[model samples]
Target: MREPAKSKAARTIEVINRLAKAYPEAQCELNFANPLELLIATILSARCTDRQVNVVTARLFKKYRSPDDYAQSDPSDLELDLKSLGLYRNKAKSIQSCCRRLIELHGGQVPRTAAELMQLGGVGRKTANVVLGNAFNINDGIAVDTHVARLAGRLGLSAHKLPEKIEADLKKLVPQEKWTLFSHWLIWHGRRRCYARHPDCLHCEVNDLCPSAFRFD
Candidate 1:
């Protein structure tokens, strides 16, 4: 039998409820002391793991203190600092350009709103949402990463291809207060059980709640 497409609210609530129950201690995995640090760390986190980001940021933070530090550094040198992560060239350029914008317009502070942050180089919806939820304490929206996107489909929560569309669907299901935690929980579950290659459905805390779970068979 064909399954019905879930409404946005239904999907959001399911993702939120299951993920929240699965990972009760879900929080931002990235380590940062302030909003500026979180913003910079989030930039470095593109296409990289949080552990890798933390390793990179440990040294990068010591070398660069503020937006001016990033803005003033030579791009080539900054790229070398991030060489271990690879894709350093583009990431370095983005960090410099984005920091320059922060200095020139926002007076060295990370912008809170997604629209404003998106104006900065490499600041997409995910990055903007991370800053909003973590740095600003406004959990208005979920930041749909690979984990959230994949789990949303596997759990029959969302069928959307685009992260933005999936995020829209999730937004409708989850209340605003739970958005950030819900996103974090899914990320935790992905890392802990539902890996890209294969999911450890048996180890999953909310496997019973998951539509994709095959244990019933």
Candidate 2:
């Protein structure tokens, strides 16, 4: 039998409660001191792991302290600094272009709203949501990363494949106040237990609540 909307909403909250307890310290793992640093880190994080991004940013942040620094940096030097990461050249271009737009449009300040964030080069819906939720503490929308998307499908929260659609489905079930934390919770769960290739269903905290539990076994 298909679950009703109200019932599913209730179950979703229960799942959130359990995951929250399981991963109390889950958060934006990419280290940053301010909005601009977070914004730049988020951009560099595309197609890369947060751990790797943090490693590079440890030195990168110290060198490029502001939008003006990135905007004015030599492209080759920036690329050389980011050479260890995949797509170093493209990421370098994105950082420079994004910073230039930030300086030109917002006076070198990271925008507070998602719409304005998306307007910058290389900043998409996912990036904008990350900045909004983590940096600005605004729950404008959920950032549907691969982890969140996978967990949503496994938990029967959404059947959609597109990130925007999955985000819409999640927003309908999750409370507005919890929108940001919900993404963090699902991301933490996905990383810690509900892996894509081999989910630890036997030890998963939300196994009973999940629809796809044990199916991967």
Candidate 3:
């Protein structure tokens, strides 16, 4: 039997369809109740896990409620709050500047667009994608974190060195409507199967669709 000679778009749709069914509960694991919380969480998530960030923010949020509050926060106190995450110094400065910019330009509210979020000091494409997707409910771009990048390569969806390049490739193949879900689904699959150290392809829900699937005969 000949395999389907479908285009990249077709495979993308197929992958999304199968995985969406498998990961119906896929969503951001970051603990946030508002846009400001999400922005701070995404920033703290740099080189950190959602679990760790959540533990820290459980207290951090209480101290800093609004952008202006963060803008006026003392770096020493903020650093102490984030020391466990490592790189606290830079993150502290970034959050301070990020919140300052938010107050100065955005009227103390988190911007809804990726471009607007990018104007903040600490926010990049990945952070912008997270804020836009989770906080503002906008699917303007895919959130290409380490999980998304590794899974995309393992699944043969994107072949690129940089996350931005991989994001562009996936965006071209995936429909806009599925971009948000695609990111969440890939994160679920990554956390479950395509792990950073070892991928348990044998137990993967979309093992057949994933190129890394185990095929023992």
Best by lDDT: 2
Model 3 alpha-carbon drift over 4 Å, by segment: 4-6, 215-217
Candidate no. 2 TM-score: 0.96
- Comparing 2 with 3 on lDDT, the higher-scoring candidate is 2
* RMSD, candidate 2, Å: 2.1
Q: How far is candidate 1 from the true structure (C-alpha RMSD, Å)?
A: 3.1
Ranking by TM-score: 2, 3, 1
lDDT of 3: 0.87
Q: Model 2: per-residue lDDT, tens digit, 1-217?
A: 9765457888999998998899899899999999999998998888888899999999999999999999999999999999888889999999999999999999998999988999898899989999999998999999999999999999999999999999999999999999999999998888889998999999999888888989986
RMSD, model 3, all Cα superposed? Answer: 1.9
Model 2 residue 105 distance off true place after TM-score fit, in angstroms: 0.3
lDDT by residue (tens digit), candidate 3, 1-217: 9897667667778888888888899999999999899999999999888899999999999989988887887789889999999989999999999998998998898888888899998999999999888887788999999999988888788879799999999989888877887899999887886788877877777776666676322
Give candidate 2 misplaced runs (Cα > 4 Å). Answer: 1-6
lDDT by residue for model 1 (1-217), tens? 9787666556556656776776788899999999988988888888889999999899888989999999999888998999888788989998998999998889998888888898998788999999999999988678999899998887767889899999998887777887888888888988998887778988777565577886333
Error of 3 at 127 (Å): 0.5
The local distance difference test score of each candidate is 0.85, 0.92, 0.87
